[model samples]
Target: MLAQIRSIDSNFGRTNGGLNQNLDSLPENEINVKLSGKTKYTDYKIISHKNDTTIVDTTLTIQKEYKFNFLRKDNFELLAFHNQGQTFNNLAYDFTNISQFPDIGFKAKLFNYFDIEDVNYYQVPTPTTEIMYRTGLEQGQVVDALFTTNFSKRFNLAIAYKGLRSLGAYRRSLASTGNFRVSFKYETPKGQYAIRGHAVNQDFFNQENGGLTATSLEAFVNDDPNFSGNRGRMDINLNDAENTFDAKRLYFEHTFKLLSSKDSLQEREFSNLKLGHSFIRDSKFYRFNQGTATTDIFGDANSSGSINNKTSYLLYNNQLFIDFNSKYVLGRFRVKSDLSTYSYGYENLQNNTVGITKNKLKGDAVSFGADWNGRIGNFYVNASGSITPGIGRLSGNRLFGEAFYKKDSVLTIKGRVGISNKSPNFNFLLHQSTYNDYNWENNFAQIGTHTLGGVIESKWGNISVDITNINNYTYFNENSKPVQFSGDVNYLKAKVSKEFILGKFALDNTLMYQKVASGNSVFRVPEFVTRNTLYYTDEWFKGKPLLVQIGATFKYFSKYNANAYNPLLAEFTLQNDTEIGYPTVDLFFNARVRRTRIYFKADNISSFALDKNYFSAPNYPYRDFVIRFGVVWNWFI
Candidate 1:
């Protein structure tokens, strides 16, 4: 089957290849008779913003199971709420994957937002379609569908949409979201000119009940007999509150080769010089609505009748770069310059008695950067840095570098270091809301961060460790106000993963350890987190037409101070009164038929047997025992 095409170099989804490798076991005639004669999996390519290419993977493995969720990614470091499309409590943080500039800061809603890197372009030998469907919390379902086709050998087009709607078990806990994307890529036959672009629109809506009330939380935590059967009767803090977030973006990049070698077969010290340009326009809106304000919970509000607040952010960016190759540089180097214009704020100026007067923050920034990629035998070096001039909100500097050593396909090692200095998110700098306690304007210094990390991947196991130090860290305190820490924060994180197989049974384990060397009062995380899965795999029937996998996963974490979700601000705030930690068990049965994979899961089965003390946050109870079914299907035409 064409579905069995495999890429030569693959680590999960990220791949690199200039050559194609076929499945030798398949008969020669079977492969030649396929459409386009491109039967290898590598022929179906997915390209990232950085132009890294990976093939569509149809194999069913334990890693695949971990990624089968609403996010469609492994959420090992996140604790999900009771329903999908809702906010998550962070279990860990990665300082290395930070943006160079500040952004519109409704972080809780950004989880479902698709960034430039999250969007992918595709090239396939035939028209290909993928559909993912899954059951939701109570009253809805989720469907993500994508279709791509190639009109010619050098041009491709793709469209995708993911939508979800669910009415959760808790009162007023309903979530609905939709994301739409269209992407295309084109190249000239001579490999001298190429272009790629994409357009995306996404919207998120959630009905917020503000979690359970004090009595309700006590009853749920104590497993009171009256509330044991039905959680709907529990009292909540808010009855008619909801929030929505919407975003739209358009992006394009084009490149042209100014000079090239005449001979394709001959190796040269200096070969190619290319010029490229990229442009992006993005806009975002966030709105909160409530029928009535909860004065006791959120303090006094400007208007007691109802609350309606909205914030808008707009950005335009243009970048130009030149790339060249030379023997002195070893591989390739790119030097670039960028100009960006941004605006973030509310519609009307707020001149309250509290002295918060600004309606918006608008400015333009100019930055210059360079990137280098070099290889010496099996060792590779990649480094990049950028600096923005002037004392504007977006003015900052960032430097990152990584070195990799690969020993055949058996083992690989990588080391990385990063340093960044940037202002906090826009919301921290200036925000205006109907609630008196929510309005703020402050002049804060740029936050500085430094991170050092290393990773080793091999057949025996996988290990990664990172140490990060931060100065002028910013956070929302228990009072729900943005505040910068006066002290430095140092953190260390380490993770190890391994899988042991014995015949048809396998046991996979992942363990993570985290520590706050300082600044624990403001920065908090659990000391230990773990997930272990034990599964049995086998083929069924005489022809082995079906492959089956049955497994149970055990996950747990130590008790620590977890942040609380605030629907009004679409953010998480510090909470020290309640410590949250729990263990959960999930059972799954999966099967693969042709290019389709089916999934059935019993989530949080431990809730039916253990104490009812599990909480996703301070007052948000974890999901109870629920059975969910889903399927992922891919078809090639």
Candidate 2:
């Protein structure tokens, strides 16, 4: 089946996951061949919320190695904790993607949360299955399985589940998580009407040790030989504490064409007039539990012996839109209006030493937006804007525009601009907890941000640069309280990536540079970060049945004041005390046989030679030398 798919991919007319196909590239006989008997690589499609589609990629490359971790995304700008399912420390920040409304802000525990846009629909000619497995820290593992198929040409369904559990290498650093999702897409034979929807349930739990104690921190830094072999013997600040974040979501959208064009040629200039309706309901719960609260560690609590605090958030959104194509508009234009209702906070009011805090924050907002996509000469332009009028909790405005220019497959250039104004995350405005020091209610001003960025992609390399400016930025201070910065924050980030291949030897390098031109005391980031890999790849055996890759990747970042993690609130706080900087190396051996790709890795190999000074954050040591293996396999029927 794998060989047949490859053959069809090479012989048939292909598209870049778009509606248009260049039949001129294929021979007459190839076009006349019956395509229903075999499934081409392009036949398996993944569609995003924005209607962009891309085929499932099965090639084994270094880029795949970078995304094979717990989050299944590139972590070039993040530093992971000791465990797989735990949270990550940010090495850089991006403000280009702005939200119009405030969020339930337990940002730390939300790393594993699957948002509505993250869910994807699928269309396939045959049943497809993919399984991904990887070994975890000590006692557990991570596995993600997916199955999707089309019952008919116009209907499709997909189901996927990802679960993880790891005991970790430290005393109280275990993580467990599960994510389940189901999605379906259907349309009429003439494509005048269509519907797509997805439902998701996800939960993330972590055993919080409150990091290491003063003694353990000193011992680990000094490389105490007594406890070098068994890290679990080290003492921590808290022994019996855990936090969990879970969410449930249901979303669906349907569209129908009120009028359609009869001529195929005229469809390019004028097409179907579509009226669409979308609805979403999302609810989330967060809880923290501690068997015993140490007053010295977390201060006085409502119940010192045992503590439990919970918070909930629920949101409902309904949007109605209309889209059409006309010669005057060039391509397509859409106008939409939506109403959103949100409730976030505790259910009951709390009166503590600090004061009395409100029980919840609830409100509704009506928003309007427009989107346009068109082509002028050799340039393609896309723009969108949205606004929520009146003074409400969710009042905001956003304007974004992008332009792209492509020259065959050799080079491409893209530029973007964005400006937004919105309130900070909900937690910053209102929060109540069992710990006296964790309770607060404040009214902070809106945060305003402007971003300008551009990217250049060519055979030589890929380069991107972004500059962002912010006003009234909000963050958690050293005291773990929300505070808005009084001064402007200016940040710039630039990155470059290139790959060089000579025969079986290849070199891939990615470098990033960050600068805080202003607000240095409030905003912190490493000045330099880099990753370099040198690998060798070749086919082995008689008929080149097995493809193999061997590589070593080295990653490093400059020392800076990295933030500290607070388990009680599941958030990172500003700290000026500890600066973390380190260099680590990973060795990997990967092989691909047909539809199965196997991976073997020696993670943090440099830890064996270098000093044990690496830390993900203050009092949180990075992972030690470890060997792990995993495989990703796919099947088509």
Query: How accurate locally, in lDDT, is each candidate?
Result: 0.86, 0.84
Candidate 1: residue pairs that collide: 5-40, 5-41, 6-41
lDDT of 1 by residue, 196-310 (tens): 8899999999999999999998899788989877788899999999999999999998888887664445653255788889999999999989898888878878776888889
Candidate 1 lDDT trough over 10 residues, lowest sum: 10-19
| Candidate 2 per-residue C-alpha lDDT over 327-395 given as tens digits, one digit per residue, 9 for 90 to 100 | 565757778999999999987864366685588999999999988777665577778899999888899
lDDT at 127, model 2 = 84
Roughly what TM-score does model 1 have, to 2 decimal places?
Answer: 0.95
Worst 10 residues of 2 by lDDT: 3-12
TM-score: model 2 vs. ground truth? 0.94
Candidate 2 clashes: the total is 0
Q: TM-score for all predictions?
A: 0.95, 0.94
User: Model 2 Cα RMSD, Å?
Assistant: 4.5
What is every candidate's alpha-carbon RMSD to the true fold? 3.5, 4.5
